[model samples]
Target: MAPNRREKGNTVSDSDPHFSGGGVAADGFDRFGTLPDCLLVSILSLLPIEDAVRTSVLSTRWRRLWTLAPLRLLDDSALRSEKFPNKKLLAFRAFHDEEQWRTQEGWRVRAIDGVLSAHAGPIRSCRLSRVYFHIPLLDGWIQTLSQKGVQDLAILIPMEKRFYLVHPSLIACQSLQSLELCYCRILKPTQPRPNLVNLRVLNLKRSLVTDAAINDLLSCCPALQSLALVHCAGLRRIHLRSPTLCIMMLDDYSWEVEELFVVDAPNLEHLMLGKNTTRRTHVKVLNAPKLELLGFLDMSIKMLQLGSTTCFEKSMVTLSTVVHSLKKLAIRVDFNDDLQADIVFDLLRCFPCLETLDVLIADMDDDDEPDVEYWKQQVSLDCLDHHLKSVTLKGFLGQRTDSGFVNFLIAKARVLKVMTLISVHAWKEGWVETVQQGLCLQNKASIDATVVFMKEKHEINQFQPWSSLF
Candidate 1:
């Protein structure tokens, strides 16, 4: 039998049998236990926290090794499982016994506390979701992790009316590089604002934060490069002026925001704005000179004013030279909307240097047909005549309107090299051959232009069908 468990203060001496070559048998065979400490710690880090802690019973040599491994504790499995009764016996019992629910909840809390208390090394990351934690206990855990030099932290709670304010220690931690918070309330700090000098990435989703609070946070993080805000309330206007910010994504599906203004991010490269279904918001891009990629999905905004223009009317759009630097553009169009077709043309004209265009067709009802004559009447744009090389049409339903639009692109784009048409629905008997034959008959401006037909199997953004070409 193994020797008695060693206390935390005990140190392994070099002369000890277990510390030396005891794992090697007399026959000269090395056992798995002979692996070095660093390799063993790595293996332990990959297992779940509970399983890793249970390994302490294997032998005296492995008793305290878990304390040295970087810990990652995520309490999301219980919430993610559909059959909750099978996950924990106590959970099943909780349905009948209120005391059992408290027991199970206490066990979960203790499990997290035990692992965090026993850890002797830096925690690489911690993501806690769907666990009900009191404000004091949550604050204590955040403070403890902050002091432990945690680099990445994510706290995601359920979308209940209850809002847990973030601990001050977490905001002021200098060791933190990435932070993501979901479904929580961010309280404004006291005067002489805190600075997260090392933070590079920040994501806030479904959180409540005032515009002033957001500006204050951004002002302190000089090194912030990427910021994403999804469905966050309490901000009617968002003004970003970061110098190092490269990517900004504002996905507001709730349509709570009324205005978004990108004031002066010079280094910004990619900007994605979710469709404003309410059609009440307006976006203005004042100064991102280096902006190359732009995506506007489900766009129904009243106005998308570019450059320093002050006009808010939808008909008064005037593109500046900054948008001409764009290399790629993605947009979604609803055929039912009369302005959508005109909006596409206006956008293409603005982005004269665009090399690739991705179009997602929305609302495929039979009554919502594209105006074929309107597409035919569109004068050739500079992008189609010179810069555009690739075009991807997702949700192509093989309608007369879709075919007319495809034919218009085929005949006008002189430098077009590849045109990908992904069917909106499943493949039928002669769909591929029919589309191919139709596209082949249309007048192609470039002899090298190739039309590729594919069935829609996955999301438009998840897989890039054009990656093989590059």
Candidate 2:
């Protein structure tokens, strides 16, 4: 203290008696001091509220850093240990003051509460993955986030026996733009918020939301652009009537809708239907003037009713219903070999203007007869016309029914360009390849066609060179 160190203009680290080899270098102070306030804030913004709060211990400069950070509320224990190997579970455990099993549960509740209380302003994004909390608390948290103008929300709730309710406040989020709910339960519709005019995207995959609830939610969002209801159970019918919806996808293994009414979607361009119950369902095609793409899978369309109820009870979809001004057509059927040849012919006849056709022709185990030169003579491709330039056949069993269609396609397609035949089930001794080679010899000018035989089940890949329009 002889000539006080501060007065002597020497740095504090140099003057300290205990600084001989303590490793408290002058650079340590500069590290925090040199960081721009904006950079510090941005770094803090990415941290979970609890982690952000711990910044205060770093230095006096970080005492109020977390107040400006975005809240990342998560069930701390629900986070698999595999993700963060360095995660100090002991620190969280101490805050929880419980055993390993019980501390995790307490951590989640505390983490959520800490984030909500600390976030004074609107949250830009919230990512809650595999979180478990009381339903009421979730509702309240959603309400809190909505009021604060949370924009992006990704919620993956724990699959519990109890139902989960979507709070009405969630829809009220005026700044909300994107929402993703996976494997969740929408127990009931919450109150509607007035600020949800800007919402655009909603994805509910493998969710437990009823049709009525979905309808109610959809009706509320007037500006919605994309809606994907994938494997959402309890929907027997979906009346999708949205003027602003450009893309609508319904892919549920248990989706057995008797009727799907598309009323006012004029701008709707892409419609995808997948894995529906084989039972009868009257699908009404609405006035989508701009419609261009339609894809279906595992669907047995028993009736093809156009604008009128004039029923055409066919197991497969007629080509007319598919190729109407559409550039891309995908048909994936799960039918038995018992299908009538006439029905298959009718299905092929409808695609007049189809430039690209990808058909998955699968048959039951009972279909073993491979020779079908005689049967091929009976099928007609005159109606199919010359529009088909590119075609793909998946799960081709090299049976009479499949080969019959192949030979007809080779002979009748006037402007055929490229054809890909893939054999599914064990190849009946190079059945598809044999057909491909035979077709090439008969029609050298019948466009470039190739067949690929999958020797094993795992060898079957996705239809290559085809863009999934949906």
Against the true structure, what is each candidate's TM-score? 0.82, 0.74
Clash tally for model 2: 6
Best by lDDT: 1
Write one digit per residue (lDDT tens) for candidate 1, span 35-59.
7889888988887776777777666
- For candidate 2, which ten residues in a row score worst on lDDT? 14-23
Could you tell me how far off, in angstroms, the CA of residue 193 lies in candidate 1 after the best superposition?
2.7
Error of 1 at 340 (Å): 2.8
Q: What is the C-alpha lDDT of each candidate?
A: 0.71, 0.60
Give per-residue CA lDDT, model 2, range 1-470, as digits (tens): 32232313545433344332223445433343555666777888877555676676654456666766654543344343432234565565456544563546555666666767776765777766633455556777887778777878877677762345556677667788888887777644655433457778888866788777778777778888888877677777778887788888766354556666677787788777653422355566656766666665333455544333222544543333543666566675533433444454554555456677677664545644433454455644543465667777777765556666666776766767777666544456555455655553475335454444444354434664223322
Model 1 ranges with Cα > 4 A deviation? 1-15, 18-47, 58-61, 73-102, 297-299, 308-316, 320-322, 335-338, 364-371, 425-441, 457-470
True lDDT of residue 422, candidate 1: 81
Show model 2 residue runs off by greater than 4 Å. Answer: 1-35, 43-57, 70-99, 182-195, 206-208, 297-299, 306-311, 315-323, 334-348, 365-375, 378-389, 411-418, 424-470
Output the number of the TM-score-best candidate: 1
